[model samples]
Target: MQFLYGVQLLIMILMPLIQMVMKAIGIGFVSYLGSNLIIDQAMNYIVSQMSGAGAVVQQILGLAKIDVAINIYFSAITTRMVLSGLNKLQDRKRAQVWRAPGGTSIEA
Candidate 1:
């Protein structure tokens, strides 16, 4: 249980950091391309639009990352809870069943 929670927490923390790094890398690539590749008016307009579009994309990616983290956290918690409940029920079932010393069923 502790290990599971620890992993989940670690993943949640790392997700945003990863997202930020990826966004930075993408922005860097775009800026490098924009500076090196501009040729004419149309190209200039396109590069400017790309810069603006990158901002919008970064925001969308951030929101998407958040959504993915939330879904993962919820899924992990819900799955653990459901599986633990099933295990408890199974234990109860085993306890209720009569068994002989040799592991044979004992008819009541």
Candidate 2:
């Protein structure tokens, strides 16, 4: 019937657009998981640990009457190192693909 043909034509026309939207949503969900679940938690833990270490160093310098400016320098260096490490980690995660023992690829 003409109605059946029209329905088929409409579905054919819409399929690609539907697929494109689904792909975009999948990508966005993965990005959200990577940033919110992984990176943010790791950054928080790193910053907290670094701050504790910096505090200890500050105390030692304070006792020695050394200028506290050195603490600032060390903090800057530590931050850069942490950022570089996190960037490498992010890149590695992005590049990695998981596979099963049976040679099947797993997708995110």
Candidate 3:
């Protein structure tokens, strides 16, 4: 019916837009968590462990004086992971279909 066709057309038009929005939201959320939660937890753990190293090591190496940039490091790692996953998914979705000699179709 015309109603069914209209509904299908609407879905076809909106599906890609919806998927793009979801992907963007997912990436942004991951970046936020990586920059905030992961970095904070890592910094806290490092500080606790460093504090336990005693005054002798602290005075010798000056660990307290050195600043650790965990946000930058963790952000780079999270970006690389998300990009790699997205690339793999894209490649899978665009995989090539070929016909074999036996007249069977295969996706590679």
Q: Estimate each model's TM-score.
A: 0.34, 0.42, 0.45
Q: 5-72 in candidate 3: lDDT tens per residue?
A: 99999999999999999999998788678667866788788767877877898675464454344546
Over 1-108, each residue of candidate 1 has an lDDT whose tens digit, in order, gives 999999999999999999999998997688557644533444456446645667778588567685466456556765775688579768886755455565576545
Best by lDDT: 3
Task: Give the whole-model CA lDDT for all candidates, comma-separated.
Answer: 0.68, 0.70, 0.76
lDDT of 1 at 63: 71
- Sort the candidates on lDDT, descending order: 3, 2, 1
RMSD of each: 21.0, 11.4, 6.4
Question: Which scores greater on TM-score, model 1 or model 3?
Answer: 3
- The superposed Cα distance between candidate 3 and the true structure at residue 68, in angstroms, equals 15
Lowest lDDT 10-residue stretch of candidate 3: 63-72
Q: Tell me, by TM-score, which candidate is best.
A: 3
The CA root-mean-square deviation of candidate 3, after full C-alpha superposition on the true structure, stands at 6.4
Clashes per model (N, Cα, C within 3 A): 0, 0, 0
Q: What's model 3's TM-score?
A: 0.45
